[model samples]
Target chain A: MSAARHDGPGTGGDAPTPAPHTDDQPAVPGTGEWRRLSPRTLLVHCGWLGAPLGSLALTALATGGRITAGAWITLAAIAAAFAVVTAAGLVRWARTDFRVTAESLDVRSGLLTRRLRSVPLHRIRTVDLTASPLHRLLGVTVLRAGTAGSGEGSGELSLEALPVVEGERLRGELLARAAAEAVAEDPVLARINWRWLRYAPLTFWVVGGVFVAGGSAYRALHEMGIEPWKLGFVRRAFEEFGNGMLWLTLPAALLAVIALGSVGALVLYVENWWSYRLEWADAGTLRVHRGLLTTRSVTIERARLRGVVLREPLLLRAGGGATVRAVAGGLGNKEENRKRSGLLPPAPRREAVRVAGGTLRTPFPDPEVTGRQIDGDRHLVRHPRAALRRRRTRGLLFAVLPVSALLAGLGAAFTPVLLHAAWIYAVLATPAVLWLARDAYRNLGHQIVGEHLVVRAGTFSRDTLVLRREAVAAWTFTTSPFTRRAGLVTLTAAVAAGEEGYRVPDLAQGAAAGFAATAAPGILDEFLTRPVGHGDRTPST
Target chain B: MSEHAAPLLRPPRHRVDPRARAWWRVQALLTLSGPMLLTALVMAALSVLFFPGALPWLGPLLLVVLVLPAVAYLVVMPRMRYAVHAWELGERAVYAAGGWFWQKRRIAPLSRVQTVDTVRGPIQRRYGLATVTVTTASTAGDIKIAGLSDADAEALSRRIGEVAQDVPGDAA
Candidate 1:
């Protein structure tokens, strides 16, 4: 634990480093290792300054051949520079590069400076290959690897102008690696994934549409010499009419919500349609691909998966399956450059387990699976009693909305005009705070699985988080005087990407050992002697 | 889901002190700003709520909550700032934390760290401070601690460079 080195959870076999490419990658004649040269096609495909170049070309064309030769010369120079730079970059990259023999890959690249990047055959978060309309015309794709931060984030590795076959071949190899990796652990390939094909994109579309609609509405109103939104609370006529006409308002409000919601949802749905595909199942990893026009394919290693979270809207609780995802490093949704893939939303819980045989979907972004079998009760799921307290508090807080309305109406009729609804929220807040305190005090049980630390809470919608000490990137604890005296501390443990990290609020002091065990087992805590308050200086690990 | 199963993952045994110049520049504001803010706020509160008569007590309290910490930083940092700490471990992670009074800390696992940047400001040259910013998935709040000597900053960066290349599964 002191200044010790931690070994990687092994992938067995000859999965170490790939053989360095021969001094020269043997060249083939037709469609050789490098694609044929065409700067016209390359400019349109590169994406860096495509638009500007296109605009310049249009301008030159409008001026005819007088400036055409000069334009062509300039264009050729820029294009040549792009090609030379790319070729130089490729040469440098290729010089230091080595690709794994298997699919779910490992491509290490670095020149005078070097790097070795690995994507588990079964732990690939997401792989996206795209093309602008122009790129499509040139038959090239930009392949990006994002360990999903909502599948947001520039790619870790990208191959440009690769023959689709080669790119697709790479993807296939990775998928095969994933499958092979999956087979090594699980005996199930339960791939029944229900893509909320319409949900996200619909949501995106509807929201975008609503924004456009609202802007259009505003423009239309403005053009017509009127203010649309300034209708000022309900119309005076409606306000005066009161409850008698409330029925009419009800329909209108419902209609507005539906119309806006629908248009927004549909617009969103169209923007990103769910192309959720369950590629392969076996091993400890699950391959799930989901996204819209920009598709994201992800692989979650069973060993790295954190835990299972079953979230339910009060209405959807019954036998309905749930949307599930895995927690692994650099894979969540997009937003961070470190993310290698997208967050995999797999099959609903029941079907997923049934499909994957008996594998339960862990809640945490990625759950770690010990190569050894689950020791049953030794890792029984547990919850603290305080979980119920939070639920109860939430239940009581739910009653406040109507109560506030009632208080507002009653106050307006009898109290000072300044005695407003604001006070009611404050009043309600007090109860909520008390409930929170009660909930915090009662929270208890936590379980220690093989190499994972799973914490559970909630009486209804349960939340179970599995932490993999091996994969935990960072850990910190913050304490106030009162909490310190109470022997409690809040831990902020990051799982590579902070987006899907864990914030354990108010755990007993002794749990630091357990938390540490889960965060970085065997790893000694460096901050004990070191005052870890230095703000914002990136660490080198 | 106990993390205990991963055997022992050498818990955060890495640290990388960024450039001293940037570190020092930000250290003053980060450490002193609180007290300065606390002082302004507390004084304002007293003026508004306690009335002018309570200035004596309010003034002392402000000194305790605000000036004391800042003064402590200025006094102790001459030596401690030079004691910049940076450690890089196993792979894919880096950490740097420093400051004399109100201490500063930052941790970035290479996987989540989007960018490794060194920022030099005019104030840094004046006071010998520099900052190394590690962007991550955490949003604007991702600016980790900053403040260090120029050499230490580069060294921390080089160490990160080594570890980023060292992570077992780094082959992309």
Candidate 2:
């Protein structure tokens, strides 16, 4: 890619030189000079017309391939809508113009209001270039520049449908300020490992995605005035399945769903992680380049990197696989942050740890060194026994009781069958609930591992966060009435990057202050009456 | 073990203005009781229109479930908050602790302080009260000192703003 040439100096192609613009005669209503989005943006915007037109065609086909008077009217309305949309898209494209000045990147848009958003070049912490199949076909990509210190809504500057080369150049230009002098010979940290494909089925998407897709399909059919239950083929299929022995059909149906879901998961994995590469581009920017159909290249400034999170979902952990995410600033809002922060796909746990260590620039202690996994659970300080009791109480109170009560209540009001089901459910679920509670309690642990504070918590998706102590902006100690009585408190380490506040839940009351004091010194020192070091580190049994 | 039994964190040195108690009460009454009263009235009217026979028990149930808690909250919360809510600005950090049943103590270092703002709503204006919001780069670390006298709020914000101006970084 020509993007690499931007770092190599002298190999400039169509890259816009950041020569100071000294135009005194600024004529175009506002700003010094502005460049409009690609003309093909109008085409991208008009792509929505295809969906409605396709639906119309399907309706005509379903109705014996003859267009009725209403259908003709609908077609005319669609054409009018298409024309209006095209005009709107054209106006939007014309209005939306962006320019990279010496100090800042400015984007101007809107018809009447003429909104202008300018972000300082220094604060531009990440630049993302994304192109969908349609966008690729049109030879354009969307560029989003995320700025530092701006919270939530107003941090990100986006220019849709910039020509592919221009988008790459813009990305290079935006991040050029932070480009390091040392040209990295081997920038590649990790690449797509085909063996990791076995971990695909372990994701929540495997089973949950099937139901979600089914729901979406059902909703789509319903919206199109088709009742799936009332369909002849669907009903016939269900009848055939029902005709088989109940025991046999139930297992077969489950197997079929599992098979379908596995296929879906494999396909999704391939699409999302095809040719995935994590690299240090120019030694200053960490770049994640991935995706098959919708190619994404997210470049994050090394200075903005707070830490790395090693995520192990239950099934993934069971399968010995984990994922890694960047805890960096200027990844945009919550949704954008999640989408952009993924550093590694579901791969071997050891590989994830290695990637995490590489990303942090500090090698995490290998299992060989400590006879344990990377920043393993053994070294971490476990929460008090009261934490376990609290979890057990919560499980019984919230999960088990509510479900059983609802069933039992319905039985009292309506049927004896529900009453039987309630007891059966309680009997079946009690062990599972207890087991989950135990697992959650076991997962809860925190430790100060040199410069990084490692916190491992959560039951379903165990996230072991390795955060820099220096990145901690503030410290918050919270205690509920119950928690206070139990002699425990939850301490949250607030940072600017990733999730913002990571909680170290249910520490012994006295130990909480000591923990926070140790994790990030000076913040809590003035407030503590006694010296924090003198405080007891309550040993967890 | 003995140290573990002691307070986890000391209460901040300064308490909010005494009038804050009254302000919080009125604030609570307006926010909690007002909507609850309206909901109760609507429920009563619905019961009277649709199921008049159920009004005898439903009226009392609504009062117990909805109205009583709101009334209790309006009366008790202000006093509890007045006792709990305290703040102290150190040279390095802003310390604030508040909440009744679920207490929270927050510390935001001056170095990381991004923006300092003072807000006064219509009700707060009537009560001559203001809230000093010290926003850090982290969304979770925004320290808000509510129920402060207007003058105090202004002075606090100015102090924070001045200190933040001197201590420089991206605050990220």
Candidate 3:
């Protein structure tokens, strides 16, 4: 393929101008023709090779001796592997080229066998730009284009490294073309507020991060042929901390772990959401730009957004804080779903609601007011008391009593210590289970207000989904033998956004049917028209 | 019956074609007979090879246990499924209701349907039967109404396609 270079001062131009290709090309300029990735990609690729070499050097220092012949051979092998990998990356960079035409974005790559991906401009749903610290140091960023399709692998196209300015211009041009309507200038919806960091530790990420760190450390020690518990320092530390009070020490150690986890959560939150900003870009799209060490910029068109989900984890809810997530299609692949779904980090519940109202304006338009008016907690219809009884019985039978009986049976069969402990465990665990069941029951609610169908449920992580009633494609009503006896049915509204369907479980059967019929008019009418088993037949045409 | 909201009781009223019961039995027999026959043969071989002198009656007893279930499944269940399987193409939606134990009632709006296809297997072809599948944007909204006559299946597919096309907006 012929490479056409654009000759000009690359910066300060509104549109990229085509330049003449020199016989001895020095620097590549921005143009509509196929262009290679920034050469700094080689440096980024080489950084991956540094870990093994650094570890080897550390091992030599720790041993404090002359390297063995085997060590020399391994070193040589590592060097050879690095060289091979670096050469591959270099060839890949050289081969990779992309062009943004008026209608589509074309990317051509692959060394041995060529592959060209052309994504039409209309189908381009999201253009995301990300830059790690190393990339930022090299003045380059990674750009990804997400298209509307199923399957995680084929939905997105990415260019690994491009000069930061070119990446920005490309993103602007693609978004401008994708949204035909003239976009209004940037109108800020939300920005970083340091006070929101308190909600960071409220997430399960803190506990999960601690567990991951501990697991990784144990794995590292195991790989080195060391039993971590057998280490003298560890044993001494545990003994000294315990001070002959094992129960107290257990709680103390847990507190220490939680404290460390909280710190880690804070650091991670700062890194990921340092400069978080949500704004309406031009006229018809929303843009989210955030991150400290690895910055990210995501732009999504207004038309693709279906609804909004306001999430409140148990702890965050207790503090009156919530997070906002967009229920939009064509934003990202399934793998990036969780990251791309987020619209606002944990903030005051009111702020989250306000931001959600702003983001969902296009989908749920209200003429009387500047901001969309969504139903608040007062409008929610709580499930009946029988639903609470169902949840309580479920929790008692499934979670609490089974474990208690097993422990008690084991204690009676074998150990006296466990026999006394069993009663305490049962008593303590029963209350916790009951409390959670009550919390879940309290959280269960569904409401249809204006043009939206709002459903809220969950104990640990409450989600209030505000979906446009018009978007609902189907309704599924399911009942089990027990649920039928209790006069309850589970109703699910199938939509094309996040989760594909949202279920409101254990509603009074009549109420659920009425709700389903009302939410999507006439869809559920035939089922309600006549009782089943009438032996009636509507003959095929 | 007094006018009241219908209780979430039984499956829907519209049943599939009556001939479906016979077709299902034949299909089940064709699909399951090979595995059942192979199992009996394997037991016979094992009796001869591994436990040559042990209880000869044990082999026959085991064979009875295995073949009895297969016989019942191939003979009885299909008829029950045929009784339960029902579908209705309503003015605005396609309703499908059925399942042996866990009865499912699904209503997919015509506006959401993306594709409709009529399929006929080899056995179905011989029996002049076909199945029509309705696919919608939501994966769970997919519906299959099987055991229709070939003519009915084609008609239903075309009707669904027409209805889906007539709807103005795409599913969210």
Q: To one decimal place, how large is model 2's interface RMSD in Å?
A: 9.4
lDDT of 1 by residue, A176-265 (tens): 434243244344333323454333322233445566777886775554334554576537656665656788877876677667767566
Q: What TM-score fits each model?
A: 0.52, 0.89, 0.81
Flag clash pairs in model 3.
A6-A19, A7-A19, A183-A282, A183-A283, A184-A282, A184-A283
DockQ of each: 0.12, 0.44, 0.29
Residue-level lDDT of model 1, residues B1-172, one tens digit each, is 2433322112233343334534453566566755586666867686868598877777777778777767666545644654444443334455544444333334545544555677767767665555677655444224353555677667766765565555543221
Higher-ranked by TM-score: 1 or 2 = 2
Residue-level lDDT of model 2, residues A1-541, one tens digit each, is 1123123343355433222223322111212346778888889987878877887777777767877787788889998998899989888877887776767788899999999898988788888889988898898989888888647867888899787776766676666666455643566889999999999999856667788889999987766556889989999999988887989999888888888899999998999999899988866788898999999888888878989999999999899999999998888877888998999999999999999998988876322112122334237776788988999899888888999999999999999999999999999888888998898888887777778888888888888888898999999989888998999999898888878888888988877887788778878777775645454422211
lDDT (CA) for every model shown? 0.47, 0.81, 0.74
Question: Per-residue lDDT of A137-231 in model 3, one digit per residue for the tens?
Answer: 88888998887652354868889988777777677656655433444533788999998899888864676789999999898756434578998
Superposed by TM-score, candidate 1 places the C-alpha of residue B21 at a distance from the truth, in angstroms, of 15
After TM-score superposition, what is the CA distance of residue A288 in candidate 3 from its true location, in Å? 1.3
* 10 residues in a row with least lDDT, candidate 1 chain A: A1-10
Ranking by DockQ: 2, 3, 1
User: Could you tell me the TM-score of candidate 1?
Assistant: 0.52
Model 3 interface root-mean-square deviation: 5.3
Error of 1 at B2 (Å): 14
Clash list (residue pairs), candidate 2: none
